[model samples]
Target: MHQYQFSLVFFTVLTQWALGSILMISLYRAATGGQELNNSKLTAIALWLICGFGSLCSLAHLGNPLQGYYALRGLGSSWMSREVIVFGGINGLTTLWLLTHLVKGKENLQQTLGLITGVCGLAAITMTGQIYYAVEHQPSWHTPLTHIGFVSTALLLGLATLALVLRQSSKEMPAGFRALLTASVVMVFAVTWQLAQITGLELNGVLVWYRVFASLMVGCGLLVMAKSLNLHSTAMVGLAVLLMVSGEIAGRMGFYGSVLGKMPW
Candidate 1:
């Protein structure tokens, strides 16, 4: 894998995680009747920091960071350009929402802004997935599965991160929330396995190690989450997040490694 690939993997995964966090946090607020404004503010700050770091990783992928503005010029035809635009929109909207929350302290307007930010974040995730799905030369990447995998990664990482952050804020987990999260993880893994079968790619390669490690880590994380719920241990939630994030990083590495572009030979 090239250095650019690594940078891209981090950029996409981190940004998606940020996006997912925002969306999940919004849902959490709504589900809990919007009582925890202070906790929500902290969560927004953490997500913004994640987005900032992801943006920096994207810059690392560039040959000349100063010319990065040129990427926005191709928005008429390039998915990459659209991805940048969408991400910018997501960041901008989120910032505006954060400011509104801080200055105005109006829950109604803040909730509205949160909804819009979540929509933009979801669009950013779609555009990120489309960047790879539009690659005609890479058969391994040009598929619906790529989009599904991207969304799944976002949800998995987003929920795990949210769980940890909320726990830190001393927020109680809503009833059935843990069960819902676990089911989502299981469903995503099942779909990913099915997609692998559909692609019919050989499972015997260096990439297989990444896949196996990711699976084991994610599985362990889910088990840990379940145990945490049973024992009511907030610390275990943090551990679960760590495991899930590491697993996702490994899975994304495999995702990049699986690319098999058309050969001139």
Candidate 2:
């Protein structure tokens, strides 16, 4: 992989993680009729900060950071340009959503902002996936499986991290939350299986396997243990989050490596 591509790996993964977190939290809030989550303000602030950090990583990925805005000039024809615009919009919306949480008597406005942010986030993430999927030179990334894998990463990373965040105050995991956790884990395997079918297992690298082990094996194992033991230890959940995040990062590295290292130049 190109040395500079690591910045992109962080950029894409972190942005998707934040988008997913915001989406999931928004959906949960909707399901519970805007029931306020414990520490929601803190969560929103953390997510907004994460978006800022991811944006910085994205700028770093551009060797000439000052020229980064020039990328927007391609908005009419480039998926990357669209991605830049959409992500920027989502970041602004996230800030507004976060601000709504800061003031009292803004639950209605907060929920509205959250839902709007979630919708824009989905579009931004799709644009991110499209950037890779449109790269015809990288067969590994050109497949629809690429889109699925990217979305799955967002869901899995977001769900796992949110579990850790919410578990901070709850004594036991809610059934609904557990079910989402299980569903996200299932998404991890489903995407992996799809990738094997799309591009044979042999083409997958050690980093890919590490991703599988970390996100699916160790991460899910911790969740299962928590359920079976009826425990909500932040330590266990936090460890799971760490493993899943690292796993996704490794997986993303494998993603770019497949294109840069194996392509016939």
Candidate 3:
């Protein structure tokens, strides 16, 4: 577990969550006929800030932050290089879209920029997954399941966080949507757990406990979110987000804990 990089855990989860939020927010807007939600602009800004912080965390993972530019040199053959490039694009485009929305107030151009930002976000997240999937020696991470898990993490946290933001802002979401979103979170976790089991990766001691606790926390959070939806309790929604975020962080730690480099026989 000593080799597990906490910076990377934060970087991957935070950036993916930010990217996922953009896509989900776009879908939500389309579904609601572009109805503007209260504080939606604030939400977008907060997400971009999160992505920026995550990008910094990624730099912290490097031995020399100044030398980080060299990572782009391997774009032709390195998943890491591609991931970095895509991440930069996502950050730049999203920031530009945010600025246009705040300053120019051009609805049509904002929509165009949003669409482009969302596409780049999706590409960035996929490339993030590929960074691990390309590790041929690490069989545990070489499966398509790695990509699935990354995307799932994005959606699960993205939707939950988005719901929290909307509810807190006193914005109205479509009826029963929160419950549906929470259910999807549960479903994603179940699928991820099943896939991990199928992989038969060994987990001992604290690692096993981490997995169990993370699952429990996430389950509890989803249940709370579902109940809060029915009760229209904003406080409960906030609590659920807290729980889910904590659980996700723990789950990511467990994921890093499970990494098994090629065993030298």
Candidate 4:
């Protein structure tokens, strides 16, 4: 991948990771009825930092970072523009929600903001997928599988990340965390299978299998170990995250590779 595509890999993966983590955090809270966990402040700060970095990666992908603001001009029509706008909103809302957490007795406001941000984050991820799905001539990217793959990747990465965060407080697993982890793994497997079926002549066979092995097989294996061993340390979960992230990056490369050589311009 070239410089811009490299930027996109981090842009999509990291942003989605941040979005997914916060969403799960909120869900976990709701499921457990406002159970407090250690390192909550640190998690918020880390997510904010990730969002900031992801935004910068997006700007770099524009080729002229200084002129990236012009991308907003197309909000009336372009999915790219809409993505930028929605992400901006997500960032702002996330900041406010983080601020709420800094204060005491704001549980109600914090939960509300978190839920809203989570919903908006979903829309932003959708827009990111739509940017590729809108290419009418690119059969590989035009499929609905593109959208499914993006969302599933986000959830998988998010769930893995949340597990790491929660592990910081207690090695003991949370009630819903295991269920979400299982669901995320299933979603990723489903997306990979569908992508394999739909992606013909667009991606290399070897690369596709590499992604399946690295992301689906190895990553899932690590997750299984973490769950089965009931390991409290971040070691197993951390490795799982690394493999899963790498897989998502490879998948994105294939997603772009399908259309890169065929650009009309």
Query: For each candidate, what TM-score against the reference?
Result: 0.82, 0.91, 0.84, 0.88
Better of 3 and 4 by TM-score: 4
- Candidate 1 residue lDDT tens string, 63-121: 99999999989978999998887777777887877776667656576666776777677
**Number of clashes found in candidate 2:** 0
| C-alpha-based local distance difference test score of model 4 | 0.77
Measured by TM-score, the strongest candidate is 2
Candidate rank order under lDDT: 2, 4, 3, 1
- Pairs that collide in candidate 4 are none
Per-prediction RMSD in angstroms? 3.3, 2.2, 3.2, 2.6
Q: Which portions of model 1 show Cα errors greater than 4 Å?
A: 1-4, 104-107, 169-172, 175-180, 198-231, 260-265
lDDT of each prediction vs. the true structure? 0.68, 0.79, 0.69, 0.77
Candidate 1 local lDDT, residue 201: 47
Q: Extract clashing residue pairs from model 3.
A: none
Q: What is the lDDT of candidate 2?
A: 0.79
Better TM-score candidate (1, 4): 4
